[model samples]
Target: MWRYEKRLQYPVNISQTNPKLAQFIISQYGGPDGESAASMRYLSQRYAMPYDKGKAILTDIGTEELAHWEIIAAIVHQLTRNLTPQEIEESGFGPYYIDHTTGIWPQAAGGIPFNACEFQSKGDPITDLFEDLAAEQKARTTYDNILRMVKDHDVCDPIRFLREREIVHFQRFGEALRDVQDHLDSRNFYAFNPAFDPGQKPCGCKKNQ
Candidate 1:
């Protein structure tokens, strides 16, 4: 039930080709804290969330993560476009070029392919929300690392936008975690899985009540 926008969440227009920079940036495309993992994690966890507010938060943020993925992919594609054999060899992109010449593939800077093991959907709302919060921070740090190596204004602009989004998502997830915590007994928040074990009544501690 999603519609095509025909536009990126953030525009990417890189005038210079830097295969080395592309190698580093590609990590965010499929790295552990990458957009693909973030989107999948939140979208999958939403199904087991116990509250409507939590579910909505996960759903909206998950969708936004997909858009972020598109932005990252565009950056990588633009960075690697119109490369020459000499540029590939000089820029040390041969290893990647041999595998997928100038093509966008999900892999870490070291060439580890994207894997589902990077994220978890624990089904427990608290656990999943906490994971979401951590994921955003991890992504932000990754962007920080990228900004340190990149000097292109065009490249940095969209990346900074993505980095800022990580902060905003982290805040939203913090709020969602608080909302979930409010429903559980503070003394024993882990007493039961809110997404399951329906018969176990909440402890109704003073803090939660």
Candidate 2:
């Protein structure tokens, strides 16, 4: 159902190798608020989204998150490529190197392996969209942290692109949240679960009420 694209969503061409930088950058690959978590969260939540617009937004953003994941992987790959053992030890990548030499694995900066616990997929559309918005902001903050520690233009350029995307996605999710809110009864947004309580009217009160 998905088409293959031979190109990266944003091109990454790093001329220098820095295992230290790679260590931090790898967090975005499998860390909390990372692209992998974002993709899975949105894609999984889409099935419960009641509105077509919400579903579409989730689908589009989820796909885009996958693209961002690939970007992060590429950055990590380039940064660790051609690393010498001496360079790895000096760069403080020795612990990581011992486990997987120059091989890209999904782990947080602290070496926590990627896990679903990093994100949530509540069946409630409101909760999920809010989580999406928060996820984007968290990702943006992570990128800012990376930018502060890194000076290489080759690395910073792509990181900046990814950060800007987080902003855009945050905006889109905000709009999606507003759309869902508008469909709910003004009296009580939580009166009913729109996704599960199909027989209830859009603005109707709770079934028990």
Candidate 3:
């Protein structure tokens, strides 16, 4: 049985609106590199995980991603609300305004359409964990770019929060990788893979220095 926590991992508040920025930010909300895919990918893959530790990692990370989604949505809402038609036209948000009227969508910053092919769930623990590690790095980079582009404090606050969470998720996935290695028999761990070794040290999950 899974326990549910409704609280966000971090708080999000938007004090003002900027339609142009809102459109760009909403791209990540549902976009390829977005939080929605991150959470769904991990949570969905948990069904095929063979170990409890792996399942737990998926559950935790997935839950955190849900918080991330909320933060992005909050930012979008704050940035897009109450825009005059002239302001929308001046800001080049007219196209989006015409379609959704301040609605959130998952297109790219450049207005490219979002696609689900951006993420995957391979079911193999090693493969999936490796993908997750890479995904976190990608998301961190995206947040960094967003921060550099936006000047609003309200927007940057949640973006910074989301970026730091990526680093933490990367570290946790690294720990999960070690957990996977520890589950394997040493003598046979690298027997099949001749290109590299699985390393000598077992997982160090509890003792963080």
Q: lDDT by residue for model 1 over 19-132, one digit each (tens)?
A: 999999999989888999999999999889989899999999999999999999999999999899999999999999999998889999889999999999997999898899
TM-score for all models, in order of appearance: 0.94, 0.94, 0.83
| Residue-by-residue lDDT tens digits, candidate 3, 1-209 | 55656766677677777888877777567776889889888897787676788889999899879878877887887787788989999999988778778877777766777677878987566777889899899888888878888888877887888899999999999998788777776666543321123333344456667
Q: Which residue runs of candidate 2 sit more than 4 Å off their true CA positions?
A: 199-209
lDDT of 2 at 169: 97
TM-score of candidate 1 on Cα atoms, chains taken together: 0.94
Global CA lDDT of candidate 1, please? 0.92
Instruction: Please give the distance, in angstroms, between residue 87's alpha carbon in candidate 1 and its true position after superposition.
Output: 0.2
Please list all clashing residue pairs in model 2, or write none if there are none. Answer: none
| Candidate 2: tens digits of C-alpha lDDT, residues 1-209 | 68979999999999999999999999999999799999999999999999989999999999999999999999999999988888998999999999998888999999999999999988889889989999999999999999999999999999999999999999999999999988897787776778988536457556685
The lDDT ranking, best first, is 2, 1, 3
Q: Alpha carbon lDDT of residue 182, candidate 1?
A: 92
Model 1 vs truth, CA RMSD: 4.3
Q: List the residue pairs that clash in candidate 1.
A: none
Q: Against the correct fold, how does model 3 do in TM-score?
A: 0.83
Relative to the unseen true structure, what is the C-alpha lDDT of residue 89 in candidate 1, on a scale of 0 to 100? 95
List clash counts for every candidate, in order: 0, 0, 0
